[model samples]
Structure formats: structure tokens, C-alpha cells
Target: MEFRRLIRGRVDEPQLERIGREIAKRYDRESVRISVLEADNWLSTPCVVDEEWFVKVISPQNALVQALFTGARNLGVFSRGEEGFFERFEDPLAMSQHELEATRRVREIGLNAPEPIEAFGVDEFGVLVLEYLPEFRTLDELPSTEVEALASELFSALTLMHANNLAHGDLRGENVLVHGGELYFIDATNVRKDGLSTARAYDIACAIATLEPALGANCTVDLAAEHYDAATLLAARDFLDLVRLRPDHEFEATRLKGEIERRAD
Candidate 1:
């Protein structure tokens, strides 16, 4: 059970093409008309295609593919590979394998992620086809309540992963997407099966630190403290304070604290 095989079950190019064609038909889009939007430039940027889908390509034989598989599952992203594109990359086989595994795992967890449509390792390049989320905004731009709700959902998701011995290596506001008023976890490439407790705590801390500033007055320190551990609450408060001190930061800490205390009374 290699990681790649674990994530992506054995499937050849002809099968992948069939799958892709099926997906295209289902979506009422032409597979041949879909063009390549971008390629990896070592930035790990999520490639956007036709304003309708995102794509991630990989070489079939890469070891990192297994890791990606686990990540995609944890984050709930969809993934598949393209046939006859293996020769397009420096090591198409390895990359294809890695991306396929990642995509497969992401699709497994029932998260709102891109859907994989095809996968195949060939001489030109190993590539993945994924569904794209549209009208999505980053968490940073979302409303405070929406952000907090997303944080709650993300924490709950992490809790479930921790219970099953999984951890999202990188959990941050930037890694979350808000589409149609819902949160979607993206970028699970660094996910692993170790340090579940620590990773869960760290992710909680990251969410608290990241979202505290945008929280409304109704979202008080005490309310947050009620939901999180003492240490995490404190860290969140400290982070909030640091941001408050910055002239450019829009939040008013003194007013928020007073509002919280008033509500407590």
C-alpha cells in the first residue's frame, strides 16, 4: 500500500479520459475546449482554469504524491489526472502520481473541494483535472461573523481529523476560501498523520489569532475564552493587542473589552 496507490487507485489514461469526458458532459462543458491556465513555477499556487475550475498537475512517480493524497482528503478537495500529458514536465510520472494521491485523499473527506475528473501517467506529463469553485473570496475579506463561523467549522474539522490521527500542516486564514457564504479548506499538501494534538492546538491558535481582529464587539474575549483553552485564549488576546497597537489596524480593543465586560454584567 504505497501512499500514491492508497490515495489514487490504479487507473490508466483511457479510463481517465473517459472519466474526464463524463465529467465534461455532466457539467455541459467541452473537455477539448478547456485550456491549461498555468503551470507550477515552484510557487505552489492553485492554478485557475476558465474561471470555472482549478487544476494541479504532478509527476506520477514523485514521493510527495502520497502526502498530497492525505492532505486532499483532510481538506476535502477533489482531484484527478490527465492522460498523454506526462512528457510536459521534468518528471511527469512522479508528479502525476503525487498529485493523484493528493487529489484522491482530499475528495475522500467530504469537504467542499474541487472535484477530480481525470488522472494518468504518460510520456508527456502527469496531470490532474479538478472542479473550480467560483465567486469565492478569501477568509480575510469575509465578514466577521462569517469568519468566526468558519473558524468554528475549521476547528471542528480539525478535531475530527485529530480524532482519526490526521493533521493539516498549514492552517491559516489565507488557506481558507469563502464561497457562497461557506468555508472551504484548501492547500492540504503538508497534511500528515502525526502530532494530532499539537497540530490541532496550533491550528486553533492560528485561527484565533487570525480572526480575533475581525471579530465584532459581540465576539468578546470571555466568549472566546469559553470556547478555547486558557493558553489559546491568552495567545489570542496577545495577538489582538499587538494588532490593536498598530495604527493601521481597524479594531478597537479597549472598546471591545469594555463591551464584553458590560455584557457579562
Candidate 2:
């Protein structure tokens, strides 16, 4: 937790005030209420604005952390005998711009994502604005039964993204928000087109890893099987352990691996 804080960093009150002012000016609001969310995210300082806009104040530190995570994920891909495919951003605004574009891409392909308002620079921070879902729960926050019920929808969304050649490089459970009874993806990282296949497999690995915790290894593998063939499952299986290394993920990778092998058989 401390390490996460170290990397995630904090936006001081003054910086938040500046961000709020910028947001207010951009939307022609006299003033906006800003409330920082208590989320276990490492990439941005997320907050709600005027109870309407879901905003991310991306700091240079957040961009650096993203670059580090991208590097590490690429190294993991290399372990699978492939070159790295994840792209790195040089600044905070670049990160914000990428997310804005990614969200638009997802929405363009008829998937759920927050309505992207805009991405702009405000001093040292890059701010991204989107429509806020006042009530929602992340995938990891749901009960086992509810999570199981959403299994098909979850995999289907992933399938749509992969089929459209849009790879969600980061598909962690937290990034999958259940809002108004629908799943909305967020925080999609940039990936190279040449690495799309590897990125797709890694996305599937994260999807399976995410479900196994809530639905258990057996059900999770079965759900994956319905959407993906045995070969793809085998490919995703190779990345399971690597996904497990992340601090946010807590699942029995060995059991998941066994289940995937059984499905392949």
C-alpha cells in the first residue's frame, strides 16, 4: 500500500483547486464541486466534478508510473518469446489524450465507456473529462453470484474489443465498472498495432484472472472457453502468471492454469 502511494502520489489541495478552476472555466461553470475518489488506482487522481463529470487529473508522476508498468508488461511479453507491444507516453497530457481517444474508439465500436468530453492541459497536469456514473461497482466489488451472472457479458465485451482490432491493454477488474447494470471499460492503455495479437491474449489472460477470483477457476475457464477456442485459451494461459504478479490481482494462478490445461485437453 505504501509503495502504491509512493508511485501513485497525491495531488495537493492547491493543485486540486487549480484543476477545479480549470474544469470550471472549460465547462462555463461558475464553480464545481470536486471530490477525490478513494480508488486503488495508480495512474491518475480521479475525482467527481459538480456531481456530473468524471475527471482524471493526470500528473507527470502518474505518466512515469504508467511507463514503468508498460515496460514491465512488455518484458513479460518478451518472456513469451515476443517483442514488447505496449506504447509509452512522454507526458501527462499524452496519457490523457490517449485515454480520451481510446474511450472514443470503444464507443465507436458500440461498446460501453464513459462519454469522453475532452482532454486538455492545465499547468503540469493533464485533465480528462467524462460523464460521471453516480452509482456503480467495480467487477471485484460484486458478489460471487452477480459476478457469475455477468460472465457472458464480460467475455462478450472483450470479444468485441478484440474483434475490432482494439486491444485493452489493461483489463483489470477495477477497470471494468458495472454501472446502471452495464459494464463500462476505462483506463485503456495504448498498444502497438503490430503487437495486437499478443496484446489480445494478454487481455484475455487478465479477463480470466479477473473472473477466476469471483467465479472460481472452473467457471472462469468455462466462460472463457465459450468465447475463445482452446488454442487461444492456451495462449492466454501463458500470460496468467505474469498478470498475477501485479499488486492489485489476487488469484490462484496455478489452479487457473490447471483449469486452462484441462479445457485445452
Candidate 3:
């Protein structure tokens, strides 16, 4: 779709009050308060629910939401019969449920993800409630050392996810939030628990591409080369090849394959 961020800003008090009321009524919960979380989210505005959970709000009638859903369908990410598929804008509950399940599965694999609570409704809008991360920072604001440390941790996390046959299809920097030394991955809607091997490679590539702008490409590449094995590195290189063809082409993959085989030897 468009390589652009969705609009994000303040949600007025009346609307926030309405959202809180909706959550309480839909989920049969009480004393739920809503406040905007850290800014700059693409599709939805995540708000804190009480002090224990977060809720991502998406209005069904919003043009941006429609455009995003349309883009998702166009990308074949939301097929008709899929587990998370929704045919109408008024049906984000399914998509929100899928996102919850994706995070739950990733956590089951021993990765970091907030515990998913429930998806609730407020009029024509949907809200995904999740466990709170009391102290978390986005990837964009980290220092060099933190970036390198995160780079290595990200590789480890990605390797573990791939080994478990899962791929975070949208592995961008913004999707990763850090607290202390722990990395909590948000926006799990696109995570593929039964993804193809190529999809896994793309996951790696997306991580690399997202990190390159913050940390230099060469530095990120070197860290990746050091963090992962030859096979994974070769796969990453294959992804780079897709983005921009190298003159070495066949030789690059072949050479990396040879190295892997030599290690076996």
C-alpha cells in the first residue's frame, strides 16, 4: 500500500469518555479509564485502559480505516475464509481477535508481547485491549549502543520466531517497543503462524530495512551477520537482492551456500 503513516492526533474528551463507556458496556467491565498512549501509531490510536491494559481504537466509518482494510484485502492478507477475515468495515472484531491470537502465540513461543485482554465495541468502532507496558520506548529513540543491542536481540527474536514457524510480516521499527532490556512486539495483526519460508525471509528483510534508517545499513548488516548464522545471513542477503539486484547475483547465494556446506564439512 502507501509507504506512509496513518494520521494520529488527540482524541477529544467527549469521544474518550464515550470510548471508555463503550468498553465498559461491551466487555461488562467497570472503572475503565482511557488515555492516549505514546503517539505516532499508523492505523489506530492506542489508549491506556485503567493502568493495566491498552486499547487500540479504529473507527469503522473512517476513510483511513477503509483504505487500510482495502489495502489489506488487495495484498491478500485478509482473504474471505481466513481466520481474521472481515468482509465489512463494521466487522473489525474478527481482525482484532486475530491480532490478540497472534500476540498470544508469539508469547507462547517465549517472546515478548502484551497479554491480550479482549476486543470490545463502542458504537461503530472497535477496540483491542491488551496488557500494559508501563515503561516502554520505541526503536527510533534509542542510542547507538541500545540500537546495536536491540539489533542483536531482534535477530535472536526473529530466529526464534522463524524456528517456531512464525513470521511477523510487518517487522518495522515502530512495531517494536523496548522496556529495559526486554523487547515487546506490538501490531501482531500481520504475524503469520503458518507462513512460507519466503515470508520468513521477508520478515528478516523488513526488520533490516526498518533498522537501516535509524542505524546505518552497513552497521546493521554487520551486526546481523554477527548475530545470526550463515544460513540466516544468506537468507537476509537474498532479501536484499530482491530490493536491489547485485552484480554478483548467482555467485552471492552460491558462495554463501558453499560456506554453509563447508561449515558442515
What RMSD, rounded to one decimal, does every model reach?
12.5, 1.0, 7.3
In order, the Cα lDDT scores of the candidates are 0.49, 0.89, 0.63
TM-score of each candidate?
A: 0.51, 0.97, 0.71
For candidate 3, write residues 105-171 as lDDT tens digits. 7899999998888776666556788888887887766886787777888888888887776667556
Ranking the candidates on TM-score from highest down gives 2, 3, 1
Best by lDDT: 2
Q: Which pairs clash in the backbone of model 2?
A: none
* Candidate 1 wrong stretches, greater than 4 Å: 1-42, 57-103, 118-127, 189-192, 216-227, 231-265
Off by over 4 Å in 3: 1-15, 25-31, 61-90, 189-195, 227-265
Put down candidate 1 lDDT per residue, 1-265, tens digits, no spaces. 3542444333344644554564467668887333333221221223454566675544343324434433443332111221111111235445445455544565576565556665554344455556688777877777776776666666666555555554444455556677886666654432344434444544454455456577755563544555556554443333345334322235556655454445444
In model 1, how large is the Cα lDDT of residue 197?
42
Candidate 2 — worst ten consecutive residues by lDDT sum? 187-196
Assess candidate 3 and give its lDDT.
0.63
- Model 3 reaches what TM-score against the true structure? 0.71
Instruction: List clash counts for every candidate, in order.
Output: 39, 0, 0
Q: How many backbone collisions does model 3 have?
A: 0
lDDT of 2 by residue, 190-221 (tens): 56678888988998999988888888899999
Identify the superior model by lDDT, candidate 1 or candidate 3. 3
Name the lDDT value of residue 110 in candidate 3.
96
